[model samples]
Target: MTAVVALLRAVNVGSRTVRSAELKAVATSLGHTEVVTYVNSGNLVLVPADGASPDDVAAGLSAAFESQYGFAVPVVARTAAEWELVVRALPFRAEAESDRSHLVVYCWDGVPDVASIRTFDASVYGNETVIWHGRETYAYYPDGIGRSKLTLPVLSKAAGRVGTARNWRTVLALQKLAQERS
Candidate 1:
């Protein structure tokens, strides 16, 4: 069994609300083993059924979740090893020194073109920095993400890929949990 980390977007935010326990049950019902949900914001660590790709796991979970809950939810799934690489390669580590909570990693379905991400004039927020590579975007919101102009909406538009953002602590926790499961 291969451990996979699933990151769900738009859960427990705005009009979408999904209980973590229910998410775990859904995973178990879909044949995932050792299902565990971290926090309530849609982070799950589970072993994919044999021969299931990350995309298959994510698509299956997303479909089942929407069918059961009546809303379309986007999920970004990564293997435990991939997740660890993302964590290790995160840029702007210095930004976390002052405000670790403001440092976030956005993971999309696949790697967005670096040219597209660079085309965005991120300079509008002089203090903010964005590093795009592979399927992850490492960002630092110096004034706090909530108060910053480089919001998720802006980032999604700029990167040309919609993704879910998790803070440094959440990313670390997921990595730790996935490692333990692996």
Candidate 2:
């Protein structure tokens, strides 16, 4: 069995609301064990059933979620090892420890278009930085995310693909949860 983390996009946001309980139930029904949800924003850590790839788990959860909830939910899946890689690749570890809510890691379903990341001007934003590492993007907003120009929509457009982000605290919590399961 492989531990997987599923980061769902656009859940419990705006007009789309999904309960954590329902999400856990869906995972259980799909044969994923040791299922655990971090928050209402659709962060789940579980062990995938035998022989299921991360893509398969992502697609299955997405389809099942939409079929049950009447709305499309894009799921980004990563294996436990991959998640550990992302966690270790965090560029702003100090900021994550100081102001966790301001530090976010955005994980893409696949390699994002490099154009946006490559062409970005870090100098344009004061006290903010966006770094692209592997399939994940690390963003730190020292002035707080609400006041920063690098909002979720902007990052989403820059990546040119659907992805999900979790705050530093949530990321650490998920890692701990997955560790317990493993």
Candidate 3:
């Protein structure tokens, strides 16, 4: 079996109404064992049956969700090692006194865009900043993410892709969980 982390987008937001337990149940039925969900934001770790590609795992989970909930759902899957790389690639460290609000969004299957991400720098928002391109992003908002332009909804419009966002804490949790499973 291969360990994987599935980052689901837009669950438990508004009326979509997917509980973490339901996500775990659906994941188990889709052939993932040792299923565990972190919080209600769709951070999950599991081991897929042998010979299953990440794409296979994703497609099976998507179909299962549609069949069980009667609505189409999209999922992104990453290997435990891949996730570890993403976490390690953080552009900024926590040593900065101003980086307390820093956040990173997890993503999959996209190229990191150099042009767009470089267009905005730390000076744009005084203390807040947003750097996004393909499957990973680093954001710093002194005020908060809610009032920041670096939000996923805004970045998605420019990046032209649908993806999931997780703060640094969530990323660490997933990395830790994946490490434990491995």
Candidate 4:
């Protein structure tokens, strides 16, 4: 069984509320073992049954979550090893060390085209920095995410795909949890 971190998009925000207990129940119902949820923002760590791939686990979890919640909740899963690389490959290490809350890592369902991501006009967002690496996009919000124009919708449009963003602190916490479970 491979430990995986499943991230649900846009949950506990607006009207799309998903309780942590329900989220863990969904994972457990999917045949995942050692199911655990961190925080209330839909961060799930589990070991998939039959050694399922991360993509397969993500698809199953998304479907199960929607079936249980009566709403579509997109999910992105990464194996513990991949998550370690995500932490290691973070572009803004100094900035992250200084203000982990301001650094965000956006994980996509699949690897987005780098050329397409480049088409995004970062100039419009002022000092915000976005860097795409593999299936993850690292963004540093110098003015903090709430006050910045580089919102998730804009980044999703630019990348031509949907994804979920976690602050640097959450990212590291998820990594640690997955590693422990693995």
Query: Between which residue pairs do clashes occur in model 2?
Result: none
If ranked by TM-score, best first, what sequence of candidates would result?
A: 4, 1, 2, 3
The model with the greatest TM-score is 4
lDDT of model 4 at position 142: 82
lDDT of prediction 2: 0.86
lDDT of 2 by residue, 58-132 (tens): 999999999998999999998888888889998997887778888989888888788877887755766788898
Measured by lDDT, the strongest candidate is 4
Which is superior by lDDT, 3 or 4? 4
Give me the displacement of residue 60 in model 3, in angstroms: 2.2
RMSD to native, candidate 4: 1.0
Off by over 4 Å in 4: none
Q: Tell me the lDDT of model 1 at 5.
A: 95
> lDDT for each of the candidates?
0.87, 0.86, 0.72, 0.89
Superposed model 2: Cα runs more than 4 Å off: 122-126
TM-score, every prediction: 0.94, 0.93, 0.84, 0.96
lDDT over C-alpha atoms for residue 181 of model 4 = 92
RMSD of every candidate to native, in Å, equals: 1.4, 1.5, 2.8, 1.0
